[model samples]
Target: MRAMEPDRHSYISGVLVMEKTKLLYQQMYSGKVFTWIHLMPIFCSSMVRAQIQTNSDSKNLVTHKPTPTSEALSGVTVEPTRKSRSDSERPESLSKDLFTMSNLSVSDPELEKPANGSYSDVYEKYVLPCIAEFLGTAFFIFNGCASVTENTEGTGHLQPALAHGLALGIAVAIFARVSGGHMNPAVSLGAALIGGLNIFLLIPYWAAQLCGGMVGAALAKAITSDVKFFNATGAAFKSIERDEQVGSAIVAEVVMTAYLVMTVCMGTINKKSTTTLAPLCIGLSVTVGILAGGSVSGGCMNPARALGSALVANYWDYHWVYWVGPITGSLIVGLLLRVFIGDQKIRVLMT
Candidate 1:
């Protein structure tokens, strides 16, 4: 029984050892299968991690480092980007770059020639016109006052008319170089209406004429201190006489002024007129109007001239007649010129 027990124990021990060996082999086989199955996924994951690390390193290298060309270009910058730079900080590199880009020779004479020409042209067109207004007004007032003063000795209407015409003619001739010789407001207004004058300059020219006329008249009055001449009834040689010829004077003024304005429109402003002698033609027209209408209206073709003379002489009796007649005449002539002659054609001639 003891030998059988020992044999049984040995058999049991061998069985146990066999069972342990089978379990060990099974675990090894299962571990091999598991390792094979996870091999592809692990390898792929490791490769992906390595690639991500490489890309990150490349991005970091790219971000912080500058290329050689970019670094050289940045170093050669002419102007500093700083806004609060001192005068000494001005970059020579910037100046050199600008000079190179411009490609301009330092000895170029033609570059400034056009600028000089433009300046001269501006002076001729703008400055000369103002000068003419000043000089013409002075001459007109001086001559006009002298005539009035001389005629105060009962020299008759012919003397005053001749004086007015001669003064206007001489002034126009003298100032023609500057302003095209626009001495009268009515004449200027007529020119504007027919488009002979620039519309923007219309008011400015009129203002100048008015101021000049006033200055001239005042000077004339100061020169001739004959205070008795201003009085209507006190002096034997009065500046203004209250004769019974008021109605005739009014009619004559209207007709003569209208004729004068019409002549200016036809001769100077007309497109088809062969006469470029604007100053001469206008002066002649004034002379003729005076010769014709002198006896009746004193031939006041220009209202500013008449008004200046009248104001200085203190002759306000028939003042309305002078203003109403001459202005109405000028307006009528301007309208006629626009309607029959066509303002557009006149514009071309003046230009």
Candidate 2:
């Protein structure tokens, strides 16, 4: 009986050790998965941004003062020519690039008319822009949602706010030349209304942005543990606690999104306000919105972002708040810009 008792105890100890080993293995595996998911988007986005900035810098090198010729270097008396006025002394040339599209449209006379059914023209004019939107939105979502999942220490909203802001700024800068950097559907709607984007591209851009959002959220989920993902509610909107709070949540979202879209329109689409720093200004607006409205509505100023996380978490409660609020907010901003705030060239009423 004594020998039998020792064997029984040994069996129990061995089973306990096996269970612990299994648990530890799972935790380590999940941690690795989380780290990869969290870092992949960030690393990729950073690399792309760096490459784009390098190209921009190289291009700007041509604008530098010309090198001295051999005659000048040999101390020949070269006549000094009067320098042109500094940039600040002259009116800033209105930028018409992808990021600054004040009065351009699909049917603008300035744009080259492509032949009917030309696949190459269609690909260059439309498909490439949509692809840029997809990549921009995807990386932005992955970074933002992953940040939310990372906020496990009960810290204030600042962490996710900064994450969203920095991600959006980097994404906008990366894609500004290709797609105008309107990652949000609300921003696209605003741009379309203001003639900064072609009206025909609205639905396509929205679809691309939404699809990107889903992909980003899925990537975020893959990187996080089941517990953290569930706890974060998959980074979906959930601040509204009661039916009465719904009204305030809707209002908060509308106001917050209005601010975001307004910044987009003014900083990127309005010639009077457009600057090289437009992307940074727009990103800061997002950070402000999230910080101010986060407690009331979870600060989801982007419907694409909200929808992506909601789909991942399967949490549908008050889901309409995200869509209705941001769209309405953007609509209001668009109307204001078209009627009053836009430059004289683009305004519909005052112009």
Candidate 3:
């Protein structure tokens, strides 16, 4: 038989008696015999009761263990008896305890929250999402710009189209949970219009996207040779050569951006049309835009991407086309959604 285990009450009593005896022993050594005599009876009785409780607990454990034949016949495995522990001491509570200790508040429906929250809420709500957006956009711009500068012959538009498309798709997929994967300002605008994004977050999201673009463009410049950078105009828009082409280029930008944003709205935001392949569809939309409009307007559907390269190249020629065209396209999509195509909850008309 296993050794006897102590029960809670008797174990507590034993602790008290041990403390009392420790103090009595010191007093007895110090010529305080009367103090020891008074404590001895209480301490001995507590020890006897503790022994009895431990024996009873041991008997319970022995009785609870199933016999081998009974376990086999029932086809069930019997787990060993364990000492009862508080919720905090259980394995399942470890992560919750860690979250509490680290000051990261997890959303618990049953738990009451304070009206005025602490810094952790702000960090989770705003700071982290912006950082994700920044990193995602930066990586996207770096890949697209680097591919443009490389400009391997015979590849023509294929390289840049695939580069930008694939980069955007991957970036969106990675950051979607945190920041909704809006690597483009046009897409962000569309999302805001469709109620996919908060209106207040537009400014901060735009700022982070622009900053990420700049960093990504800078990184692309650093990795490529100066000659290549100059040859490609630092991946800036150089297709529109004549004044007359400005209108055509703007139309091209508007059409292509609208196409991309429309795909984003339908694939990612519209509940009825949304699918798990949203990231893939969105990427393909960019690919198609670049393939179709590459020669006309450089297919720069994202203002942040355009601004990054323009800043690095010092090329402001028709730079406004990049911003105005995409923004106009986004506005058109927003109007269309409100009037016709948006989901039921967000749609304003025909409800």
Cα displacement (angstroms), candidate 3, residue 266, comes to: 1.2
lDDT of each: 0.61, 0.80, 0.83
167-221 per-residue lDDT for model 1 (tens digits): 7777877776567567777777787888777777667676667667666776766
The best-first sequence of candidates by lDDT reads 3, 2, 1
Better of 1 and 2 by TM-score: 2
**Residue-wise lDDT of candidate 3 within 41-139, one digit each (tens)?**
445656676677667666787788566787678898766664544534432333243234433323344344535577777877788888988999999
lDDT of 1 at 17: 35
Q: What's the lDDT of the predicted structure labeled candidate 3?
A: 0.83
Better of 2 and 3 by TM-score: 3
Off by over 4 Å in 1: 1-127, 152-154, 225-228, 231-248, 274-277, 342-344, 347-351
TM-score for each model: 0.57, 0.67, 0.69
Candidate 2 regions with alpha-carbon error over 4 angstroms? 1-117
Write model 2 residue lDDT over 1-351, tens digit each, in one string: 743643454455344433433344346345432233333333343345434544454456546565699987898856544333353432222112211433322123444566778997789889999999999999999999999988958668998999999999999999988999999999999899889999999999999999999999999999999999988899888897789998998899899888988888888889999888989988898889889988999988888999899999999899998999999999999889988889997798857
Task: Report how far off residue 2 is in candidate 3 (Å).
Answer: 38
By how many angstroms RMSD does model 3 differ from the true structure?
15.9
Backbone clash total for model 1 is 0
